[model samples]
Target: MQIVIVLSLLFIAIILFATEKISVDIVTLIMLIVLCTTRIITPEEAFAGFSSDFIVILASIFVLTAALEETGILEFMIARLVKIASRGANILLFLVMLISGTISAFMNNTTVTAMFVSPLMGVSRKLKFSASKILMPLAFASILGGTCTLIGTSTNVAVSGYIDKAGLAPVGMFEISGIGLIIFVVGMLYMMTIGRRLLPNHQDSALTEEYKMQKYITEVLVLPNSPLVNQLVYASDLSKKKFKMLNIIRGKEKFLPDYRTRIQANDILLVEGEIDDLITIRETKGIEIMADVVLEDALQSPDIRLAEILITAHSNLIRHTIREIDFQRRYGLTVLAVSRQGETLRTQISDVKLKLGDLLLVQGAQERLNYLRSNQHLAVLEEFSQVLFRKRKGIITISAFVLAIILGSFSVLPLSISFLGAAVISILTGCISTDRAYEAIDWRLLILIGGMTAFGAAMDKSGAAQFLANGIVDWLAPFGKISVLAGFIFLTVFLTQPMSNAAAALVIVPVALQTAAALDSNPRTFAIAVMLAASVSLVTPFEPSCILVYGPGKYRFSDFLKVGSGLTLILILIIIFMVPVFWPL
Candidate 1:
């Protein structure tokens, strides 16, 4: 009965996750609560996952990555990449994938992917290449690259921890690197050859039209009979409707009108708002649309509005409140919108807190705009004219990261301590700032991992894992241990597509371990198979890396299913074949 209850809860969690009816973190927490309330697992056991080393490591890594971002280090590296790859689009794409994949091998793949999206989009646009072609490749490269190292992804670290907990010798970093290298090679080859051809070549055009804001700016004349003749600008639709009253030209005196100033007859008000809405306002508010003057002038002289600006690490805008920035005053530019990771900011953009990699849609003087590229503290992502700053900090940051890897790999220090120490050294050496360090860490992801870790414990302690494993073992007894191992791997890979990779791994690892015990085979082998299968989900664009590229690539959901499904199939076959060979039953 406990087993049935647990399975039912698990099924419900999966459904909730698939439908996104509730947040994944919430779903995981609810599962834990249900398990504990029903006495399926002890409260202590249900909460053990919160104290797991995997959570600690993931949290620390977020802080470390956050520091790197704050110091403008990633931007510096991308700038250099763009300068070196000035050859052509094909070479640029290849180099970008190569670099993105290589970096993802050591860093968090999502963070690495996020750092590159803006620059990659800018580079693609400047080179007159389709962003859609490069973005998907970039996302795929990060996913493939993550397979190369234990620290490459949280999934890898979680699996390793699980192996140690299950009383098996943990796999060395290079043990999986061999197969990962092969996968990377095959994946990159496909991207450069056939995959590139399959991508859509959407033509470059201004994205502003998508917002439907073209009709917003219009001019109005204060007629003598207007009721608003003696009223301040704030009392009229210009202020009420959030239109910027740019200027008033009376006779030959062109003056920028203050928002609080009153209007008079013959004064022209340059306002911005939807044309239909403005027409309605004019009719209702007793004002006349300056169609012959403002409309005709706008039609005759089409002004090009472009904004160039730097994204600073310490800007209060990072991850909090965009509305607080008062961007119009702080930057002297009107923010039409913002773009991040190929996804346009869909919220009330003016109120959204700016993150480090955000690309602002600004409108200001072109001359002053170009100056933003030279701001070393913030990356002027779209401008390629600026020289890349190869400051000494790059060496310091790289060395610190390398030292951490060595210490962790050699067991000279615990993986958590090694990274923490490296992060400290990087800060002290001026490689990254304290503010940036904080921004670099992904707090939401950390919370999700921590919460899910506890959920995993609940699954294990409830006998849920054991019961499921036993049932599966009984069902597949005729096929033997290898088939059982294959079944587990296939099950995990499928689960990962609909749910998060971490959640899927946490769900499957316990069952796979239990099954391995029943078959008298190596539990570590089964655990590793589950780990690899869960992390290598290339069959959908739901992953963060994939979502980052989805909008920029102009890719349909079907595109990923079409191309990524085949890749997933190949990966599954490889895992099934390789896990047995490396850790024999």
Candidate 2:
């Protein structure tokens, strides 16, 4: 009855996780409560998972990675890497995947992938290659790279801790490097050889080619007796059709037009959009395109173009509005637009206010741009060509991180202590500010992992794990331990397609352990197999890293399925063959 209840709760969690109707962390917490309340598991056992050393280690690693990011170290490394690659689609793809995978082995894969998204798109456009060809491979490489070390991903750490509790020694950092290396090589080779062929070429419709609004912007005259005279700009297609009024010049003064402002006679309107759209507005709305004056005529003498700037936590612009800071006079930049997550900006940027991590689209002279970036606060993303260097702090930050990994792997210190020490050292060395480090840690992921760990513990304590394992053991009795291990690996890989990789691993690990016990086999083997399988979730585009690159790559859902399914099949075979070799069942 406990097994049935646990299984039912597990099924419900999976459904909720996939549907995303509520947060995954909330769902896991609810599962824990249900198990404890129904006497399936004691409260003490249910809450024990939170105190697992694994969660501590995972949290420490997050802080360490955050420190590296705050120091601008990863950005510097990636910039140098992208610049060195030879100018060709195939070569660029190979270099990016290799570098991304290597970095992901140490850093958070999602953050590493996010750091490269914009730069990769810019590089693809400049080189005349399909962004789609490179992005999927990059995402896939990060996934494969997470297998290289125990600290490469949370799943590996969780599995190792669970195995340690089951009376086996925890796996070393490089212990699984052999299989991981093999998988990485195989995956990269497939991408360069076969995967490249499957990716759709979308060079023509690329963002750089299609979204260049510089040529479309022109000043237009709103003449007296025109049909558009005294009409609100919002009432016309200007608002509905996405036409932007850059500025309005009247007599000796010029103003950036507001959406609600009404058009007046002889008003010189600086408008930007496609030529066809501008022509349609001119003809139908009785506005005349100003052919004589350039864009600088209505604004300051210096010309400006829209640029998207990512507001770092350290940025001076945080919480301050354009009016409050006198942004134009103080920073010599005008915030024309801002976008946060998926929302678009409709109000005047200055009046809309600012927040940490907001992506702002600003207009300013190209020369003073670096001033805006270097304030140690804002991360200007428009200039992907320039390499960011933390030359002074790089050696120190890298040394601290390496020392932590070395100490943890050698058992000189627990992973939690090693990483925590490294994070402290980083802050002490001034490589990263304390506040920035705090902000960089992914609290959402930590919460999710913590909650799910508690749920996994409950399942184990309730005899639910043993019951489920007995069923699997009976089902696979005709087959050998190898078949049973392969079954667990395949189950994890399949579940990861629709759900998160960490959640999938958590759900499978207990059952896999139970099955091993039922067969009188080593649970460590099953644990390791499940961990590797969970990390190689390439069969779908739902992963955060994959989604970040999806639209930029112009890839369809079918594209990921077509290429990633093949990769997933190859990885499954590799795991089956390698698991017994390294960790005999």
Candidate 3:
């Protein structure tokens, strides 16, 4: 009955994750609640995941990474590297991926990708090559690089903590570096040689057309007899119809409207709304829709700026639509459109709930965008100025990261404590504020990892791991130990598409450990394989790193399928044969 209950919950969790109707962290917590209520796991067993040492290590890394970001260290370093490598497209791309990949091995993959996206976009324009060419390789390299270190990704730390709890030897800092280096090299080589040819060559287009914002935004000349004339801009007919009045052009002056600003005769109002309704306004008394409006001329002025602002995983505005947040009033920036993956929302963009990695095509004053970058956890892609660049702060932040790694690697301090200490130093030394430090941690990811860790305990407690292990061992017993390891690797990579890398690996590790025990093979071999397999999921753009690039690179679903599917296969082949030799299956 307990096994049935756990299995049923697992089935439901997989479906919920695939549908994505609810957030993954919420789904994981709901599963834990069910498990505890059913008495399948004690409160301690269900909650043990939250108290794990790996959780500390994971949270500390977020804080440390954000400290570096706040100090403008990583972005500054990347821009310098890009400038130095701008001699040729081939050499430029190689260095971009190499530096990004190496940084991602220590930093969060998403952060590394975010740091590089803006600069690379600029670089691609300078080289006259498609961003699709370099961005995809950058995303892939970051994911592959994380496989090279125990701290390279949260998946490694979580799996290490789980196996230790299961009574296996703890993973050393550099234990998997050899196999990880092999995976990185193969992934890089494949990306440069075969995968490079598969990338799309979508040329950079105008910001308005790139995000499909021109469908809604346009210019209209207000006639002298218009009902809107002499009315407050905030209370005009356009406002009632939900047409966002972005700017007012009278004579030669271009100004963003406010409550004090009133509609006047012959004023050209720059507005965004449903395209058909905006065009229909020509028939309305006293409105003339301007034909063949060049959006660049309407939107850009001496002080007006257009750029892409990314909603980060830690953004406070996640799940809130543009209207709900009063985004314009708060940030003084108009939302021209929001791009998710390859789909750009131009119609009713206000109703589209924001998600992590969604890019907002915004038009605002230069000062306003700069203020947003300083105050918010958002990235402005076309204009990412390193406003917080302080020489001393940068050195201190980098030293904290280095000291933590060195201390933990040499056993001077436990891994978790060493990272925690670094996080504290970042806070104390004025690198990042206390509130920002807390906000920098991706609490959703931490919850997903922590709650799913408990789910692994439930899988063990309910005998589900043993049951699955028995089936695998029975089926693959004749095929030998390598075959059983391969079975688990296949399961892990499949699960990663709909699930996060850490959650997928956590779900599979227990079953793999049980299978290894049944086969009397080295459990470490199977554990390491699952960990590496979790990061090898290039078959889809579902990975956070890939999602970050999807819209900006203008890649299609088939682009990832054609290029990443082949890379995933190659890496899996490396894992199936190479992991056993490293850990001795």
Candidate 4:
């Protein structure tokens, strides 16, 4: 009955995770509550995961990664790499994949992809290649690289911690290096050969390409007999249409119009609307359309510039309509259009609720845009040139990180303490602020990891893990132990598509351990296999790193299937052959 109840809860949780109706962290918390309320696990056991050493290590890594980014070291290093990789397209792709993979082995792959997006765009322009050709490969390389180290991904740390609790030897830091390096090579070669051809060439449809607001904007002269003459701007017929009154030009003077501002005869109105609407207004509303209008003519000043800004997940503007936020009044910028999910939204944009991953084309003064850097709301994608570098602080923080790694490797300090000390040094040296350190840690991911770890304990307590493992072993016992190991790897890889890598690994680790014990095989080998498998087999854009590049790459869902499927299959075979060889399952 306990096994049945636990299995039922696990089934429901898996459905919720895949459906994404509720957040993953919430689902995990629910599972913990159910387990505790059912007396499957005590309250102490349910909450124990939050105090685990792995959680501390994971949080410290987040702070350390943020400090490295803040110091401009990553930008400085990537810029130098781009210069050297400027030889040709293929070489550039290869070098970028290698660099991105190496960095992702240390930092989060999502962060790595975000850092490289603008640089790779610069590379695309310089080499006359398309971003679509490179971005998918860049995201995939980062995923592959996460397989290289225990600290490389949350999945590795979670699985290692689980094994340690099971009384098996913990995973070494560089234990996966041998297989991981080979898998990276295989992925790189695949992208260079077949994956390159499968990728789209989106050079012509760059985000800036669609930012041509000149054609969409028009100047109209209010005729002497116009009904809107001497009418309040808010009460005018122009408000009924989709046209937005940007500014009013009367003779030599210009003014930005508001609701109370009145229009007069012969007053030139700079209106932003569709071309068809502008033509219709001229024919029906006693307005004269000006020919040969330029973007400069609509705005009075030459100081204002147009650029693309991405709404990050941390942005305050999310869930609010553009007009509700009074975006023009608050930021002193005019939004031209919004790009999201590979579609350019030009009409009804004012009513569209902003979401993360939306790209907004905005025209504003350089000073106002400069203020955006400190806003922490929107990222100005155009201005990648201005990088902040604190050389002394960067050197100190980097040295601290290396020392932490050394102490951890030599067993002089626990991995968590070493990294936590490094993070403290980074903050003390002013490499990153306390607030920035807090912002850098993914609280949702931490919650999910913590809550799910308790679920692992619940499964163990309820005998659900043993029951499932016995079933799997009974079914696969006809095959060799190696075949059973391969089955677990495949199961983990498939599960990651529906859940996070760490969640998938944690869910599978307990079962894999039970199965290994039943078969008299090394449980640590199965644990490590589950961890690495979770990192690979990323055959969809559901992964955060892949989602970051999806829009920039201008890729279809099929593109990942075409390219990532082959790579995932290759890596599976590699893991199946490599795992037993290393741990002798």
Candidate 5:
């Protein structure tokens, strides 16, 4: 009955995760609540996940990564490496993947991809290369690189913690590096050779059109008899209809409009809204929609500009529509359009609920855009031309990070303590503020991992893991030990598409460990394989790193299928053969 109850809850959790009606963190919390209420696990056992060392290590890494980004140290390093990597398209792709994978082994893969997306866009433009060719590789490299270290991804830490709690040897910092390096090399080679040809070559368009914002922005000439001609700009029909009047072009002089500014006859008003709204105003107010004017050109000035911003996981805009939030008044910026799940949405943006990974085209003051760069919610997609690097802060924070790595690697301190200490030093040295540090930690991810840990405990205490493992072992033992190992790897890769990599790995760890024990094989081998398998999910863009690039790369769902499907299969084969040799399953 206890096993049936745990299995039933697990089934429901998987369904909820796939539908995504509720957030993953919420699903995890609900799972915990069910486990405690059913008495399948004690409240103390159900809550033990929150206090795991894995949470501390994962949270600290977020702080350290954010501090590096805030001080511009990570950007500087990437820029220098990219400059040296310039050659032809194939060479550039290889170098990018190589460097990206290496760095991803230490940093969060999403943060690494976010840091590169804008600069890689700039590099692609300079070389006359298609961004579609490089952005996918950048995202893919970061994911592959994460397989190289225990700290490279939260999945590794979570799995290690589970192993320790289950009375097995804990994973070392660099224990997986041998097999991880092989996978990275194979992945880079595959991308440069066969995968490069599969990538799309979408031609580059202008910055405004690139974000598909042209149709939403329009220009109109104010007529002599227009009601808006003599009225304050804030009270005009355009503002009433939610059309943001970006600028007033009076003859050759361009002026930004404010509440006090009044429109004059013959003034050309550049505005952003649905075309239908602009057309309605044009016919009703006797203003002519200037057909020949370039909307992008008129929308720019020394003070006002256009850029792309990504909706991050922590953004307050999630699940809220633009109109409901009164976005313009709240952020002092106008959203021109939005890109989501590889679709460019130009019309009815106000009605669209914002989701994580949505890229927004915005027109605002340079100052506000700069402020948005530091905002945890919105990620600016264009590179800031001005260097904000603080040399002393960068040096101090970097040194602290190195010290933490050394101490953790040499066994002088536990990995969690070392990283947490480094995060403290980073904050104390002023590399980033206290608020920024708090914002940097991906609280949702932490909660998801923490909650899942309890779920794993529930499965163990209720005998669900052993029951499931017995079924798997009976089915696969006929094919031998290698086949049993392959079965777990296949299960993990399949689960990752519907769930987060960390969550999927956590869900499967208890079962895989029990299966290994049943077969008298090395449980660590099964644990490590499951960890690596979660990172090898390249068949879908649902992975956070892949989602970050999907819109910006202008890729289709099929694009990931065509290129990533092949890579995932190849990596799976590599893991099946390579993992056993290292851990001797």
Candidate 6:
């Protein structure tokens, strides 16, 4: 009965995770409640994972990494890459992967990817190459870099914490670094060669053509006899008809229209609206449509520029429509279009509610666009300036982080204490503020990790892990222990598509450990295999690092399947064959 109950809950959890109707953290918390209610785990046991030392280590790393980012040190490094990339496209691709991969070994892959995305976009635009050519590779390198160390990814730390609780030695900071580096090198090579050809060549087209908005914006001259003359631009017939008054030209004066700006006879107005509505307005409102217009001329001026803003998961703008956002009043930009997955929506874009990974094509003054860079609400994928660096504080943050790593590596202090102390030092040195530090941590990911750790305990407590392991062993024992390990690694890779890498790894670890024990194989070998496998599940853009590039790269879902599928298979083969050599089965 206990096994049945646990299996039922596990089945339900997988479905909920895949459907994504509710947040993953909420699903995890709800699962905990159900387990506690059934007495599968006591309240103390259910919540114990949150209090583990790893939670501290994980949270501290978030702060330390954020401090480094806030110092603009990462941007400074990327700025140098841009200068070097000017020589050639191949050099640009190679340098981006190399630098981003190295940094990801020490920091969160998502943050590392985010730091590089805008700069690469700018680089690709200037070089006149397809952003699709490099963005996917950039994301892949950051992810592969995380396999190099225990602290490289949350999945590694979570698995280490779980194994430690199971009475095995926790993974050393660099214990897996040997095999990890091999994987990173292979992945980098694959992305550079075969994966390069598989990558789509979606050119960086102009915002108007890319968003399908060329037909939506045009100029109309206000006739002398029009009743709309002398009316405020914001209150005119055009505004009532949902036409966005972008710019107004009266005589020789041309400027962005304001609420107070009144229309005058013979004034030429640049407007954005549906083509059908625009045509009707000309007949009904006494305006003359201009001759064939250029999109750049109608939308941009000396003061106005075009850019894309990525809606991050942490962004407060998610779930809110552009109409509700008041982009003009708040960020001083107009929402011209929204891109999600691979589709672009230009019509009714203002009414579309934003979601994680949505790319917004906007038009605004350069200054206002730069302000979006400092705003935590949106990731502006445009001009990045390294002028915000704090040289002294940046050096201090680096010193503190290195000192922490050394102290922890040598066992001079507990790893958690070393990192936490460094995080505090970063704050004291003004590398990052207390509030920004709090925001830096991915609370949902932490919650999922902490809560799912308890679920692992429940699986053990209910003997669900044993039951599943027995079944797997029965099916694969004939082929040998090596086959069993391969089975678990493949399962983890598949599971990571819908669930987070950390969450997927946590779910599979217990079962793999139980299977190892049943077959009298090395449990540590199995545990490490499952952990590494989770990080290499690059068959889709479900990973956060991948999602950050999904829209910006103009990549289709098929693009990942076409490019990442081959690379994921190659990495899996490397892990499967390499694991036994490192730690014999």
TM-score against native, each model: 0.83, 0.79, 0.96, 0.87, 0.92, 0.94
Model 3: lDDT equals 0.87
Which order, best to worst by TM-score?
Answer: 3, 6, 5, 4, 1, 2
Tens-digit lDDT string for candidate 2 (1-585):
777888898888888988877767778778878887888777877776677777777776776776666667777877777787636776788889999999888877876776776677677767867778888899899879989988878778877776676677887888889899899999999999899899888654412123333456777787787776787764644656766556677886666544457888898877656666766765655667766324333344344444566654334565577669876566666555566533545445557666544556566566667565544455565547444567677678788889988998888998878888888888888877877777666555666776666667767877788777888888887888889888898899889876778878887888888888788897878888899999886877877777656655656778888999899899999999898889887
Where does model 2 exceed 4 Å of error? 204-265, 268-302, 306-388
When summed lDDT is taken over every stretch of 10 residues in candidate 3, the lowest stretch is 381-390
Pairs that collide, model 5: none
In model 5, the worst 10-residue window by lDDT is 381-390
Look at candidate 6 and give me any clashing residue pairs: none
Candidate 4, residues 1-585, lDDT tens digits: the string is 889889898889888999877878889888888888889999999888888898998999989888887898887888888788878888889999999999888777777777777777677777878778988999899988888887888888888877887788777788898888998899999999988887877664433355556777778889999998988875678877767777788998776665568999999988888888777776866788885355554564555566677775445686789999999878877787887767788888999988666778777677878777545456676535537767788788788888988898788999999999999999998999999999888788889988888888888989999999999999998898988999999999999888888998998999999999999998888988888899887688888778767766677788788888888988999998898888888
lDDT of 4 at 229: 94
Candidate 6 whole-model C-alpha lDDT, 0 to 1 = 0.87
Residue 432, model 6, lDDT: 92
lDDT by residue (tens digit), candidate 1, 1-585: 777787888789889988876766777778777877888777786666567666666766766665555455676887789777757888888998999999888877777776676677687777878878887888899988988888778888877766666677655666678778877877888889877877777665554553333456667777788776877865664567666555566766555444456888888876665455566675655567765224323322123245434354333455555457555555544565566645566435656656554566565544445555544334444545534444576667677778878887898988778888888887898766776676655555555666566556555766888888889999987888878888988898889877888778877888888888889888878887888888777878878778656655667777888777777787788888887887787
Identify the leading candidate in terms of TM-score.
Answer: 3
Please, what is the whole-model Cα lDDT of each candidate in the order they appear?
Answer: 0.70, 0.74, 0.87, 0.82, 0.86, 0.87
Which scores higher on lDDT, 1 or 5?
5
Q: After superposition, how far is residue 80 of candidate 4 from its true place, in Å?
A: 1.7
TM-score of 2: 0.79
What is the alpha-carbon lDDT for the whole of candidate 1?
0.70
lDDT for 237 (candidate 5): 79
